[model samples]
Target: MNVSIPTLEQFREESRAGRLAGRVRLQLPCNLTDFPAEIFSLADSLEILDLSGNALSRLPDRLPELRKLKILFCSDNHFTELPRVLGQCKNLSMIGFRNNRITHIAPEALPPLLRWLILTGNQLSALPSELGHRPYLQKLMVAGNRLQALPQELSLCKNLELLRIAANRFDVLPEVLFKLPRLSWLSYSGNPFCSHNEQTALADTPVKQIPWSSLSLQQKLGEGASGVIYQAVWQSVTPIPVAVKLFKGELTSDGLPISEMAACMRAGIHPNLIKVLGKIGDHPEGVNGLVMSLVDASYRNLAGPPSFASCTRDVYDDDLRLSFSEMLSIVSGIAGVAQQVHANGIMHGDLYAHNILLGQNGDALLGDFGAACFKPTAAAHSHALEKIEVRAFGYLLEELLERYEGEATAGATFATLTHLTALRDACLHIDPTQRPVFTEVVARIRTA
Candidate 1:
């Protein structure tokens, strides 16, 4: 599935020779300071254009010539402002300006059909109120910015499903966020409102400190926005094998690495959650890390990350099917873990199926704290935060039911489906106050 990238010279030569006429995608990143005029040769068919990792400050005014361009990425650039001409690209639905120097976005900078917008790691202090006018907008990632508040107009984005406003200057949680009906995933840690509580919780949590000298690193298991996980051997009395997550020491779309580490440490232990053994100490590179129990090889991710079309929802294999029991077990395990996490005053902000792992017998393990945050101290605010996550769990249940292969009109299966449907509706109640807490959700599942 890997398409070979063309070198700058090759691309130039192909375009000059009229050989790139029908190409649908183009990725040329060679430190160019200006948009390649040659790209215009494929204007008739190009749908995706990636100009990331470049030194350009502005895109060509004729960018709208590519009438078919649906996605555009201009990350890691020196753009001081979003190009105003992008609004002319009527077909553009997704735009990424991550890790850019953009400090301003004109009211007309966004395209009409925009659905997903990524402006993470920018210096913006405010956003255009025009953002709320985009009826198709679903995912908005503005983490690591300097914004003090979100425009109340954004509450009109009724279809917004995922949002990341972490590491901002907000003094309080935005009241408008509670009004979004489809906000299933959210991460707002590292802000002034709840930072003190996070530090206090981290200090109160007790954990062992494992030194780097006693560990031998092995192959890399996986990498997330905050850290790289590796399969390492802990040179303890018995030389145990464990997974070590080394923090990247940078701001991610979710938030700071330190926040994620604190949340993981505070999570403690749960039967259906990944076991954190201890924290890493005296690293050779002075990197922050955690030591966790290595998960079994038989366990695999239950689903893939969200795709362009799926927006905020996880993408499952089209042919994958699950029996009624298997689906129920996965849901039950996640519900139990969520109940325990909430009781500890933590919100697993990114509680989608992609963060869950499933074993051969349908046993589930919920991992990844990159988007988690501590709850507010106020009782009402804390309850509302848990309910926001309840909506995420409700989406998880909805996704599983779509692939359920069991009969819905027969005996126990029929009754179970009906009960689960009602529970999902309750969890997804538009009124956050009306939604049941994880404790109630777990009880209902157990009885069903």
Candidate 2:
């Protein structure tokens, strides 16, 4: 949450240095119309350059001079097109231009070694096939765009693990997308593929609707890309403290807030899932909200979100290690929740470690339905979609194994770990049909 924004004075000081010990990071927020020419002086060692929150329209043509530059952030800028000079940066791997007016991306604008690319909230309707050439590309975020279809060549990005193509105009799911080997996390909601009637059908369901006037908002608990969560006390005959999520009520990178609310309501109650108390109604600001049980303070995020280097995969602290039993308990709980949610004709599209909460004893609760989608149970592809999420679970299991690092291998523990490894492999098979369903996964883990 805390971003370090450098000042012009710091860059001047580094410029004064004879380039031997020049600063490697130059982050400035000054509003300007052009790139500073002096920045090229430290091109030898510059690694990260943040020119976000500026009025720049294009980058300098000689950007490739920065031989060591790796990360570039130019979000919240004025631009009608992505600067083609970006593709010339040999060492650049990460490019972020979120919340821009970019509508066109030149065919040569994508760096060859690109690993993580973020172009959220843009006006792009199409992308060039050159994007498919980036062999190392992993995380691609293009949500909130005007895209109607994805470039078929993008399927060549075999390493892509996480993708966000939601809030677009696509009429159907891209078949090539399902062929990716490492696609574990995805969000394609709010497109033509989603039906508004799925939520309209629940209009008269037997669920309580709590008015906003009867609740007293308290301290904030957490927040995500979709909404902000706060602690609140619902005043009834007997007052009760609960968690309230007041949505921003805007089209997020995933989808509309209403769709998320419908998915949460449909999820209902499960032991390993957050219990929805009711829906907030009659708000003063007309903001959409939800009421849910307040989780205990002991619960913490299981792992951190993906980093720039580990794109599309969760990152964990080196010291964080769970016991064999604890890891099994957490995985089993999540698998059970997956089975229950899929049974209710719902797909938890954004299943990742960061969205999971873990108690001290490693009991897991799956939360966050922003990327969830409601699918018809009789739909032909419903089963296939469920298998795709099983791949996400396999990815989580792999991350847990990496964190453990074979440090807790006792007699029985080692045997259990071996079985878990096989299970993960089976779930991560290249062909979706080869993967076992959540019900089978739960049964296998229970017997192990």
Candidate 3:
């Protein structure tokens, strides 16, 4: 669905005629060189203000005048620093400054109520220690930066659940991250600590190489931040249909595209994973891609991506409800797949409902390697990494349980719920060492 953005002239006219008053959301992507003074008129009702794709370098000192603003996006701009006045907006909870030239953040730049913050594709060498002061922060994206370390105080953010520190200068994993109690989703693939001869890991994976001439591209099936997936026909003797994922060869909020492709190549085949058939060779545009078995048409995403309000959790359909049996099957399939993936020494970093597809009977296929990373060779590091992902699975299970419409107080259904709840608790243990391994989780779920 295309959302029509108001043109600069239209917005100016609306502001001049008092037509924008009481508007809760406003998006103006025109090549703006200045923060529109007219926006101040909507201070009474504006909650979302998107000024992305503009040429602005600074915000007015009175930005806090928009007392009701809750979300602000100024990506694709030229700002060198985060406006300190943003801290004065008591209600501002989400801020995105992606793809900006920002190199510094003032100590008072962050809002007190910040829950979601995006600084992807910035030039910052370090982050403000004051970041740890935002108790409400839950999701943070600081990929594609130059930072070598994180503030030790960040461990104080107990509610932080999802974090992306990929493509940075970290020589080792920050010890502070392990202290985050609710960190369920994490991606740190392209840093120096993990990037040493990473390609050699795929040397033993005997995946076939499928040339571009052997495939016929049809229509785009989907597109994510890293690549475009197409429904294509493999022009072999049998002309079988397949899904082709072509990488965009750029840094994403999660990590680099080459990292994702490498992870997918190393994932290999599994019943619950989208089967990777071969690596695309000799593309006309020299693009890197993967050919995978096409999923059945009946399969659909289990849930939608996180919303502005949900921040780190997936959002489900309002009418969606699952019975105990269906929920069990889905969770069981995912757990089984996760067991196999971790055994192969890969972490499905972005393990969430949005990354899962479900069939009518509740069979699940886990897709998307955009946030995946290989485990470090060290036994201790690998174990801790896997445990972090275990928490992500726990959250997924919790979400499904919340949507379960089964008989909670009855016989079999109640027993099943009790069993699953215990499994979720085990996975969500605050101490990574206490969380059950995927092997144990799979075994427990099977017995349940």
Candidate 4:
């Protein structure tokens, strides 16, 4: 309602002097100067308070005075860590500290009643072990961080229903996570381990052994605009894992013979992509279903909030992040595999994170050639499209690394940005005559 500091201060002073307001929602102007510490004066009646977007560094010393506070919004601040006194706010329910420099989340720093904790777009490499100890933390958003792995302690939170840990450096997810019986919904895209391609396998890929009737289908993993993924599994399986994806849909094209979708999937084979272990031919339950490798995971959309601590309220399960090096390694590997794909004259039109697979070893595979158009003269066309694809790689790299100027290295957060940008700018020079070929990218990655 357009409140100035003076107005808010008057309430705080009056309240401390013993007055009351039903509830309070303060919106600190994004560029405001001094923070109104007086807001904490109402220790008894205040239930919900928002002090987002101000130049405040440390929280007000008297914040514990807001004994009645339930939800707090102290996002977009300069705090390195949350104040320990906040734990005293026994009535707190939800809190957001997005877009800050917070790198640590101690065990006892939070209230027991917290259910929604959002912390996206921060410098968190791994979640603190203490964080898993939260009693009522039902929803957690720790998306875009430098995490290399997940903690086993997370399974201890029996009430945790949804987990969003996308855009981290994880290659092998903790197997213990699936033990949480209440964990029904999860999104772990952008992780180096969650493979993107769930179709086709290299020559001689192992056929997955399955006891069909024992498996119960929970729900379908919508494979986005490219393919279809599923969440079905055999009963009594430890960790209750599910099949990651399946193929066998739409078979006809303009004026083309009806080979049937099942025939089309069974024809191709690649080691990196999901292998169709077995097929249930034309069953009444579904059409020509092909059994594929199980990822024990699900796909998530990247159109929601950042997964950092501050992004709690602003983000959803869909919002995920992708780092530069991870993206580059993924793209480079995909390009290498595409060399094999080009042998067959195919192009994976949608070559983004949504279509790439991060294998258990952090290797990436190209998949989802749905939009692919056949190029009979693919060998000649590769020359023209190689640089074009490289430029696309650069754009994706920018999104992966949040910076525009830095090499992709262990310390460089924005690794591919500066490296690829320089090459792309040269390749896409106004005088098309100046672009470097795809060989440069291969050479760079090899040396890096």
- Among the numbered candidates, top lDDT falls to 1
Query: Which pairs, if any, clash in model 1?
Result: none
Candidate 2 wrong stretches, greater than 4 Å: 1-21, 201-205, 376-379, 403-414
- Candidate 4 lDDT tens digits, 209-260: 3455655676786654223567676554454455644444432111011111
Per-candidate local distance difference test: 0.90, 0.83, 0.89, 0.51
lDDT of 3 by residue, 257-290 (tens): 8888888877777889999999987898999999
- Tell me model 3's lDDT, rounded to 2 decimals: 0.89
Ranking by lDDT: 1, 3, 2, 4
Clashing residue pairs found in predicted model 2 = none
Query: Which ten contiguous residues of candidate 4 have the minimum total lDDT?
Result: 251-260
Q: How does each model score on TM-score?
A: 0.97, 0.92, 0.97, 0.42
Give the range where candidate 1 is weakest over 10 consecutive residues by summed lDDT: 1-10
Q: Give one digit per residue, the lDDT tens place, for model 2 in 1-448.
A: 2234455556556567654245677777878678888788878778888899989998988899989999999999998899999989989999999889999999889988899888989999997887888889888889889998888889898888778887878887777676677777777777776666345535744568998888999999988778999999989778999999998867666666777887888886899998888887788888888899999989998988777667677877778888766788888899999999888878888899988999977799999898887764455577777888899999888888776645545777777888889999999998888899899999988877
Q: Which portions of model 1 show Cα errors greater than 4 Å?
A: 1-7
